[model samples]
Target: MLFQNVIKHCRHYTAPVSAICKPSDVFTNLSNEFPYYLPKIIKTSLTKKKYEDNIEIKERIKNLSEYHTLAREPIQGKLTFLAFDALAESKDLTEEKLHQVQVLAWAVELVQSYFIIGDDMEDNSETRCGKPTWHLLPDVGLLAINDASMLRSFIYEMLKNNFDQNTSTKVENYVNEAFLTINIGQYMDIMMSKSKDFNKFTVEQYNFLNDHKSSFYTVKLPILLALELCNKVSQDSYENVNKICTDLGILLQMQNDVMDYIDRDSAPVKTSSDIQKKKCSWPAVTALQHFNEEQRREFMNCYGRWESEKVERVRELYKEINLPHLYRLEEQRINKTVLEKIKKLPDNATPSADFFYKIFDFIHQYTEDISPSILKSNVSMSAI
Candidate 1:
């Protein structure tokens, strides 16, 4: 049995001393350390197709599958966090159980990859994972849409093949439901951009959007799925896990919004696309709260033009209002609140809570992606 065989590997595994090890140290080898079961799963699904006899169709499937496999690299550790946390909490903590969780983690990553490919196409994004997006490749174009669906379909294949048939059905339902929620959130976001009304955007709506679109998939889904697989989730624990993970997700999404305005890379680039898209993001919505008549008018003037000059103008306006400082302060406040909430989770949910805190620390403490200005001082949330 795959589960029993998993013990051979776990026997060699040495638990790292906590605090001495970085989260990166835990996840740095995810792509290499974990078996690449995703490609095999994808191949199994693709091979079942009757049209494989067609040479051209076969080549396209091969190319799409290869891209899918290639994109799985540089794992972001979302799955690692859930799998290891579940393993930590398990009474058995057997190699077989850990292996099952790891496989499910791959499923989570594959689901994320599916959406990312489709999202890039929707946003007309040029690059992903430091390379051209799948849709942007020569002759791929709209065919990437089909490829994205194929990836989504492969998630079910992985679940069905790896788990008990009955349990796989539940997992499949959860995956589909999560994607539906994400699609609704995406729809709201795209509609908000199309409407282009900054005045109508509110903190409530921003939170609602992130809660559905970013939080559910990025944090809640992975933890919940892992817990389900472990047979460890309870009603109260489920509610609490969702609450904590949702908050963390919203905080992370806001960080993304703020980072958009800042110089994230060594090289300077164009201003954030949110500015160009006129998307109602956390930072932008917060800025609106503080904007005076003149500043509001100035913002309205440059909010959503495709021109680089207009984007630059919005960047300057953000500085004029000290939006960056305000954003930093808001982030500090949110981070504190999220940490406090995580700490308050019930004893039953400690594994889930610890998983969240590790992620929070990794993002807030370990990563230089966030500027020092944001983390250095305690800022009042009511400052605005």
Candidate 2:
């Protein structure tokens, strides 16, 4: 599992580096401070034999760790551990900053778990990270919402417990701001799904949708949270980090869309969740805007419908439109632009270049292996 691997890697580091050795340890330590720790409640309740015998509740909690391990297990815990270790290595990280980063990492993990739980329910998904999704197992369903909410509450608890001091107001403020941004992005994504005409979507709209819905949570929030934890509280700091992180987030999401269409080995059952949901993904909206009228009509006919043959027809249109080539070009361009932007950051303001570099490296490593076929064609957003 990624979390386990992360724990192992962090432990391998000597002395101070070992502080972040275990995420569960981090969560447990931080949660001890919260006035109300829901995981403690869930944990206590689940340990009761009767509760475990309930079968349904057991499955949901059981799946929680599984969903988390998906992101952690593959990279051998390198992502979170590396992020945390960067702070450990920093000569400037105050005790408060160090604690904030730990709590922040915990908060982000909680948020991610919340999303995965709710997303599984929303998509009616059956499995995640090789096991049944929370909603799919007996006795789970709507309770998954509560489980997700528990994850959200954990964020507040961590904040209140660890950052209640006056000096930490900036960290508090940034956390709230990032939360608002994510909510706004999620709202836009839901609204786009209900939109009437797929053809009406512009490339700009597609970019906006992807930037908000996918980018903020994955890229923007994590890095911004890091900045906040580092006590880099100036508006300039937030703005610079936000812009860079948002761009990286958008690129990561675009790559995700591309991967869904192309990667056959992906754990998600179907690749066309975005198409089925009528998401205004970059490729879909781009195709709609750029393809000739005849091709456009063909695309509309096949767009979100579930038939296998029609999905194949959509793939054909991508090839005809040279979408794979376009996607490759756009990806390379965006990556280069992001790298240049990162380089331009004032040396003092940015963390070690290796920190940012590792992040981009992880994104590239994950998405680069995906075949162009999955990327150039439309796929389901729900799958993620």
Candidate 3:
């Protein structure tokens, strides 16, 4: 039924252009366009909770449910929307906010789908969310790359279809900027793992990487997309929101890093992904920052290698250095700052504040004590 719904929408646009659009061209274009429809359908079928405002936002969230299915191996249609519905609801919905909400909800799903698919391949991960990963399916390995690309393209299609041409262009610029920023962050993440000069990385570098990689898509782009869609952008608001979201993003990733050290069951990938890859995650960098020379040498020796003992050693070192406590302290400070900034927003700008605070609450729940096993799980468990 979900696929049929998407096919129906694809037919609406494809039939008229069939004469001009090549058969292959139509199929390919429609394939990209169809994914957007899936998210909407999935959200509707999965979500039953009643919201007081922004029914349209709910509708848009329904659109976002498609990605979970797309990201999974057996790829059941029913399970697709389960993850994103929660994320959509986390942002208070409103009629005026529907388009932006839907766009962002769809964008987050698209971004996650792309990253996880590619990450599966890069990490050689065999399974995801208790199922085979996209790259692990028979004949799906390298094709996952193309699938990821299509996921990225679908974000643009959704933007263009929902907004006027002018707003679409701005949205395109915003997506492109975020895309490039995340790519840079990904590159830094990969490079940090490979570099022998692990000592060269500072806490500032860790912050920079997380801000660009995690923050851009997770916080900065979503809020900015919402504001821009509402024509709410201004020099002051833009600067202020950007700073706030960036800080939030770094704190979120730092929490993620801390979770890696503490929560063993929830973390999806191998514990060694960060260490084996020699990733310069927050905990590692912070340990380096605070640890004395002898402790630092022990950290360097234990990290950047794949031995189980070394990994255990690194974990012990984190506890010994009280990195978790430091992480909690930073999270509180950043969260307070984010809240203060939200409170300062002009009354007319309440939607942005509402949307932002909703996300902050959502992130706070998952990242506070337990490390979320997979980011998608938060979306799944919280669906409507």
Candidate 4:
């Protein structure tokens, strides 16, 4: 009964595309048959594994998408603004590309939700985007795989309805490639963390993870999508975009690693997912790099264990190594490189190099990783 009355039901599908076509609308018009789109697959995986007729079960399955939607950030959605902004950078955004942006941005949201749900399940994560993981909900265990699949299905359905054949095909190709690259990155993360052998760790490994794991989908895909919408995609432009995203993506993962440790005590939404999961991140790799043979062997012994004492030892080791100081130095270097790459963006990339600098500042402030007591110490990060 999952799709039962999904469209015909007035309450769930009542809002018109016009009603929720604005970026401010969190739902993104899916409930209202966006672009006259509808799912064609009847036996969705939600039912492929198991099907339930209970109204509440259906409601919980629905929330798989809604929860992530409720917690959605504008990280990717904001890229869609390139289209609206291209129409008038100096002028305020009117309806000049509102509908199209809304549709495409929602597609991004759906795809993101798919990945988040799957990641949570894969990590055995307790929460996502500050809410309980969907897979952890009552009667939802294992069924979340199907729920994530369902979210993914919407992305293609909606895309088919909204974009031209050429743009849609290009976007589909990028998305397919991102899925493969991102999965490989995720697999590397899982395998590396599980291995936990000091010999397996390397700076080169960290850079590889950053390339596929952090940046491609998050930065490059959205930027490419935005370029396509703005009629600016070119081989040369993509090369520049790829380089910029790789640099920024590395910095982004570094921030995630450092910020988790630095803001662990104070930041409202801080998480130690990386530490708990034993993921190969900037801090973990860096800490191991600084460790002597004995120290590295000692860490490997208990690094990935979930027990309280083991986790505490890992935390103390991070402090003992002064990871915060190392992170600040790396942050400055990475940010400088990112700015230089942006400056080389052919001078016609949307929003210009100056705009990315502004974004770089906004990213820092938004992340609020500056709250670390150590960060406020002798080093001045004003240049970054």
Candidate 5:
């Protein structure tokens, strides 16, 4: 029924089909370009190292490539590259610079894949990118864990190989710092999920979680890294640009949280794993504010259970609280505030700002459209 309602509403949602760059398009271009950076696996038997099992390493990279190039959905690895694209479009970049950007873009995607594998294992997720998560595969069980590490190491290797010594050092340090930030954010997120105490979930905590966990890696780091590569960062307002990027990251993460409940395409189940796990996601946190004491008590009784009826009840409660409508309103408010900030940005920052606008527009088509009421009334039509 939830899926049906989403379908019913999505038919009315509209955005320009021409101007928008599809995630699939980005992924396709990235995939075609990714292999150029991947080293040809060594086939010789004479190799000496303490931990490097050549055969296993080859298999891992092979699997990584296969996992990334999934025919149906492939990894949406291009999310990071949007920033790179934005920077490149801001000026006419040379082929050599373009290749450097592509390598770094692939590095960002590799980081994403590395974390996704670990996150799925931690969440006990069944699927990712429309396929069984790498860890869940028949041959990959626990080996996927090591493969994730390999993926991460591959990033540094790529950086060292492709970049000048000084540039590589800075880039590596930036990525390492981002990894630390995301790990801290992940720790807080895990702790919150384990606690299951909604009292601890506040707007401040939400912003912190999203900022460190999702913002840096998803938006800010990519833009910062690409701008460094483009030599455009020093000319712009770094703090202001970072503020817009972080705010957009929170909005994107909220959209992801909402989709977990409403989109069946994410996993095999009709119900959300976040609801089942009792994670204090944006929707759950927002929906809690609308419930009366009695209703709140009743809601908690089924908040993290594994029953179909309980999940349905939770959905009904969400609808009763008009969360779908309120979510649309919040989205519009955030978008408006962000666009205003972008408009006020200094001239040097405008191109990057426009790039952000374009990326958000492309993402909103999927993230916001899945909400039934949001899609139906067309209440938040974002110009592309």
Candidate 6:
């Protein structure tokens, strides 16, 4: 119901259907061109390794495309195109300009693929989108590390191929900033998980983790790229749109932290690893604050442990404190708050406010139309 109520009073979404790129179109373009940088990457693998006789490595290079060709919602690409398309309405974007947007959008997905592959390994995650993660595939254990790096290398290659020298340099700054922030955030996350010290698992720390680790790169980067292309980087609207991106990033990650604890059928759960892994997630932080002394002892005892009985104790404590219901209330408040913030962005200005509103519209459709019973993994990926 909070999901339904959210964005209800936000501006009525009025972006023209003809003016925007569809998710299906983004997906088609991404899948069609995903292999663009593979040959070059494989050539490097073959030449650099000097492993022509190594059948296992040779086979990996031959089949590298399949690792990246996985079908996805491509929310980042879609958002990038929407932001670019929104700006286009003011001054018509040429076909070449639109093509450049597509190239960057493609690169965003490559970044995402790298994150998923590497994060899964780091978290010891077993499945993704209902399939075993890349590292779990035959003969891919530690080599998947190189595979993930290979995926990341394509992003720079795409940028170099598509943008002018000055523009390429500018975009590289954005890429470097995003990569560094996410890496630091991830390091903090893994450190906290390993320690399992409730003193360090404060809400303030969780907010830091959420903003840097998942939100900035997921929400902020694509929007920044679009603004960069529009030459709106110098305008005040840049910071205005950025604040909104930050808010939505907070909201998006809160959804992930809460959803991690929600019970579900065996299939389709991307992971409940957050609990067993002792992630300093939202629910854990919230519950820690409200817990009594005995409760705190019990929680710290059960949390972050792998055994089923300990995991069950965490579940029981969550139910006793009504964490799921508390999350619903908090979500409703944040959802309304973020949508109202988006509404305040000037529609007639440099970066159209309509873009952010329409981005929420896409999220609205995904939440309402797709997988109502349980929000799909895409919900965790992003929409804002």
Which prediction has the highest TM-score against the true structure?
6
In candidate 2, position 261 carries an lDDT of 56
Q: Kindly give the stretch of ten consecutive residues in candidate 5 with the minimal lDDT sum.
A: 375-384
In terms of lDDT, the poorest run of 10 residues in model 3 is 74-83
For 1-384, candidate 5 gives per-residue lDDT tens digits of 222222223222233432545545444565576655444322211133343466666666756854643322211235445656665543535566666766676666566667777878888887654467778888889998888887787777767766688888878987897788888888888888777577877777888887888777766666677767766666354575577777777776786677666644434211247887777688788888788997788788888887989977887788778776777777777766666665566555544545655655644554456553442332221100
Query: What's the lDDT for candidate 4?
Result: 0.59
TM-score, per-candidate, Cα-based: 0.78, 0.72, 0.70, 0.74, 0.78, 0.80
Ten residues in sequence with the least summed lDDT for candidate 6: 364-373
lDDT of 4 by residue, 174-216 (tens): 7777777878887888888788475667888888976887577
Candidate 4 has what TM-score?
A: 0.74
Runs off by more than 4 Å, candidate 1 = 1-31, 34-37, 43-77, 80-83, 86-96, 264-272, 349-356, 362-368, 371-384
* Candidate 2 error regions (>4 Å): 1-66, 69-84, 87-102, 162-173, 263-266, 269-271, 351-358, 372-384
Model 6 ranges off by over 4 Å: 1-69, 90-93, 346-349, 364-372, 375-379, 382-384
Q: lDDT score of model 6?
A: 0.67
Per-candidate total of colliding backbone pairs: 0, 12, 16, 0, 0, 0
Q: Where does the lowest 10-residue lDDT sum fall in candidate 4? A: 375-384
Question: Residue by residue across 59-125, what tens digits does model 3's lDDT show?
Answer: 4333223435444321111111211222234243444344344455565556656676666677666
Instruction: Give residue 266's lDDT in candidate 3 (0 to 100).
Output: 61
Summarize candidate 1's per-residue lDDT along 222-262 as a digit string, tens digits. 76776677676677756876766676667667766766676
Q: Rate the local accuracy (lDDT) of all candidates.
A: 0.61, 0.56, 0.57, 0.59, 0.63, 0.67
TM-score-wise, the better of 1 and 4 is 1
RMSD of each: 9.0, 9.0, 15.3, 12.6, 7.4, 5.0
Model 5 — TM-score against the truth?
0.78
Question: Which candidate has the highest lDDT of all?
Answer: 6
